[model samples]
Target: MNPPNVQYISECFIKPKSSADEDETKQPIIHLAPWDVAMLSSHYIQKGLLFVKPSSMNDQENTVQPLLEKLKESLSLTLAHFYPLAGRLATSKQESPPHYSVYIDNNNSPGARFIHAAVNLTVSDILSPVDVPLVVQSFFDHDRAINHDGHTLSLLSIQVTQLIDGIFIGCSINHVVVDGTSYWHFFNAWSDIFMTNNSSISRPPPVLNRYSHVLNLPFTHHDQFVGRYEAPPLRERIFHLSAESVAKLKGKANGECQTNRISSLQSVSALIWRCITRTRRLPYDQETSCRMAVNNRTRIEPPLPEGYFGNSLQIVRGIAKAGELLEQGLGWAAWRLREAVANHTDKAVREWMEEWLQKPFTYQLGRFFDPCSVMVGSSPRFEMFGNEFGMGRAVAIRSGYANKFDGKVTTYPGYEGGGSMDLEVCLLPESMRDLESDREFMDAVCI
Candidate 1:
């Protein structure tokens, strides 16, 4: 495929469409929760691009300007409910403290940046398999993609690129402020506002009280965490597991167990974990583990409201020896994954947060490579197809450079409600090459 040539058109700051004049006196400083602070060291922005092909008649009738106008208007209206996205990040002191804990200064209203561009390419050019790294580096805004200093943050920025065949709506959201679910919530709401042309009927008010349970922790811990670690060299690629493959994995996993059917997530994760352990050829006795990110919204006591928006997530890890994962059947690995997930009860989440508060600078150093660990992030359950944004459903979804770390993986559902999965796997070049050639792994993956 030919390299895409993109031309920038215009850029602007988008603020809330409506604001209350009398509410200017409200508290502007939103403190960071311990959970939120842990993400301050995150250098990669959660990047996603949605591809859509408008109907022929609509495509011919609506030019770029009209579509962009509608998007900006709808985005502004959507921001009114998710007001934190419009705010900026700042430290509490003049000079940075040990770990300058950051806060969202809502009073300043930094606003999200919106950009318009035109690319001399087609939807197929990207959707088709290609050098994913080159494509991501070319298309995304890497300069400000991740929060480096915690001193400044765009919070959210969006780019609407007009391709020859269709349009791509790419967005970069700061990880410290929101997770995948929260990001989609804001996006779907924006889509609703535009499609229905009625802000009141589009999205219900998001519950902002979700942060009330967060324990206030010092920001300096962010500096400590960032200072303590350096990322290893890594490469990323997207692999697809078809519905058939996923079903087979589940069946195989279930067959190995006397009872207890593993979930699709556990099945798939177990397959990948076993493959990675085999591909790396780790020693049988070497300890191996999978740290899976779990959503705590429903798991917490008196569960958070469905619309509660914030970073309500925890990392639960399953540990086993390398031999145990590779030598055993699929069910064994799946059971480990399931058990780790089961242990993260509401009480467990609360305890985890408290522990972080007590030792802000601590790191889960064991979670990284000696080539025996993988951190599984995101889930296939998120409704990526629902991010229509006034256009047709997205044909494909992708991750940004933020996922550039060894032993990191992300999963999204296959296209159009399919039960298949798209796994974004990042690892050291050698490990990736080995995994690519592993016959058993390659056989199950969509070619």
Candidate 2:
């Protein structure tokens, strides 16, 4: 049998013909800045679901229908203020971080937005237990395009099944329009507003107002980045952390280190670092970094408002010499990693953010971040994991975003009482083999 096919379908969208002399006209929504279009397109490549059984769901949710209405209304009102970056995706020429417009076919009465391609995910649990259903989903093919005919753009298709329970909705909002804090607030508000009527999402607070629009700001400053930088190459691989291993690493080893403040994530991260350093054969004291991402919604001074959107993020990096990281005890390694992450909310971080926004290459810098870096951060913080229709608590959740960097790890907690952690690590496959071989590191890991 032939291997599974990665399907693709493309269609052209033209703006409504404005006059007899012209065949078609592209809609204004398609003219959004290329930088802005990317903010909307990157969400597609991030994470594929490991659908866990949900506790509950309403089959008749018609969730998308209601959402469509809200989005339309929001777009109209939102476009008035954000036309520079709203409507369809933009089409830019860069590929490391791809960019394209969301074409529109205005010929349709509703001015359907034209997408160049569409991906159909056929969901079936044919190979799984009879009780499970194969839940197919579609991934719109609009990663890169040009001359976005907003009039041709169409609705993004989404489908859910009763057999599956939890979902990991990872979004890649343009940094130009939102930061981490702003994005989550928008997410929280989007959920709240959509879940019920009369639910108002407050406007995002004023965090980053720095914009050059031009290559030159008031006073321009540029510097070379210190760390090794690479782009995150896409691939398919399961981030494996077996149940038995995690338990032993987390403390199944000895009775002495029992009853501690260490969470599974912290313990696992430390072990991962030590094992990685050992596997890589790096000398002690060599400056290596472990980075993690932290959401700043609740951390902003005066607190940002509910609907704030834009890039509000902090890269917490832990650093220690190869010798210190590997030779030191687990507690020492964990502490070093934690301290490196301590900068998650320093005043300097905000200054760095403001400085970055003032940069013309902010997007370019984002594109340069590889997945193989020796840093890790827990993401898709699901504070509201209670939004399930049926099935049961999610058995696991994971993220497989391994950019070109060295050590990339993320942890997602299961639903209440969902015992094991769903840890996702995307590293060079060869390096992973070495990680698995480190018995000392594995023993220190507390799952």
- Candidate whose lDDT is highest: 1
Q: TM-scores, in order shown?
A: 0.88, 0.56
TM-score, prediction 1: 0.88
What are the per-residue Cα lDDT tens digits for candidate 2 across 388-437?
Answer: 21223334332222122446555554444333444455456566666656
- Tens digits of per-residue lDDT for model 1 on 270-292? 87888888878888899988888
Give the lDDT of residue 2 in candidate 2: 27
Error of 1 at 295 (Å): 0.7
Give residue 290's error in model 2 in angstroms: 0.4
Worst 10 residues of 2 by lDDT: 130-139
The alpha-carbon RMSD values of the candidates against the true structure, listed in the order shown, are 3.4, 9.8
lDDT of each: 0.72, 0.40
lDDT of 1: 0.72
